[model samples]
Target: MSKTLTITDNRTGKQYEIPIEHGAIRAMDLRQIKTNADDFGLKTYDPALMNTANCVSRITDIDGDRGVLLYRGYPIEQLAENSDFLETAYLLLSGELPTTAQLNKWKTNVTLHSMLHENVKKFMEGFRYDAHPMGIFLSTVGALSTFYPDAKDIFDEQSRLTQTVRLIAKVPSIAAYAFRHSQGLPYIPPDNELSFTGNFLNMLFRMAELKYEPNPVLERALDVLFILHADHEQNCSTTAMRTIG
Candidate 1:
């Protein structure tokens, strides 16, 4: 015979009745019941920091105790060794690896949109030498809405695609510029021939006197770092997005 399970949320005061297989009832257990606040260290509990309830991106899962991170169910170690940043981003956003054809198409799309507008570059030049890079990045991203207001049409797949491409392309440039500005150096244009991570490293470290070539081991390690930082559900930023939305 089939069984039914009922669950209620105290916060929302909502109840759900779910049908289950006959033996599924055996999975229900409520033996551990303790009310003393001391047992759970109530003093250490901070409601402001507790944010596991919100849900957002399906990018990565983090297990703090085990020191493990999985991106779209793929282990971080595997992705770092075998994958690139763009591939990992695609996996996080789309939930799977792109087929060869899809990858080619995606790469082409991103490459085509990599160039930032001249006006935006002029705006960057207006910032003071002492300005923080993160401030510049945030302001520049918000400025994108003004330059391409059509991106606000989030329901359009093409618009979303364009925005995604623009962000992926320009972020490295922005970061490199921020690095250079700290040293009072001019910004460098991106080199299209190189891979995403390779291009970023080149932009940051390339000197007029020396040809920059990224170390493969370092590139792979950086790829792993990006993968590990990709996403965590209900994280601070994710929670802020939820609250804002």
Candidate 2:
């Protein structure tokens, strides 16, 4: 006998039943078996420390020589070509492609919270006129810990969500502010109407005296750039996430 998996489409409010044969189910059950059998009998001397990369979820498996990188199982190239950074982020956290409605709701939540507090802005102004942008950026993010000590709550889902939203929304804003500051110009506010890359371009180049026309070819290229840069497993920054925890 075979079994079926039932799934519902949240956006359209529809349901589906996918049939699975017994042989297919058996294959799936077998795939879950750990292939590295030697570790089964090994004894650990340090109980507090992980013996062999206990942090599997955080590190993405990439066969770079094969041009494949996956967060869990979702393909990076597909995500880069077909999705935006925010939606890709949701995929990273939830382990599934979000429905169109889910994507819209998620984007709206992030866009609405993009602006930083006035006190943070004021603190940024105290940096020396010639300070490097990266220094300012690191210090500003560290300062966030002081403002919301609860940001350290890694295990709390809501806190993690809040911090994720804040980071995604504010990173470009802070970057743009640094560029303008280097030129002795005032910081520009973000335009909620623009997409992530679009807003970054606007913040960096848009001005009252000039009209900025974004080229579609360039926009697509920039989107590709962000997607390519979006995530890499166990890179320096990702490794930092593990260390911080």
Candidate with best TM-score = 1
lDDT of 1 at 37: 33
lDDT, candidate 1, 1-245, per-residue tens: 43776756464465555565433422222111123334431122336745224443456777889988888788888887787778878887789999889888887777777677889888887889889988887888888889998898999998887788888878888788777776688777777887777878887888884557888787767767776666664467667877576
lDDT of 2: 0.72
Per-residue CA lDDT of model 2 for 1-245, tens digit only, reads: 43876546454465555555532322232322332554242133534333324254542567779988886586777777788777777877777879999999888888887787788888889999899988888888888777778898999999988988888888888888877777788777878878877777877777674445556677678877876666766567655666567
Alpha-carbon deviation at 162 in model 2, angstroms: 0.9
Worst-scoring 10-residue span by lDDT in model 1: 25-34
Clashing pairs in 1: none
Q: What lDDT, from 0 to 1, does candidate 1 have?
A: 0.72
Query: Residue 72, candidate 1: how far off, in angstroms?
Result: 1.8
Compute each candidate's TM-score over C-alphas.
0.76, 0.72
Off by over 4 Å in 1: 1-46, 49-52, 56-58
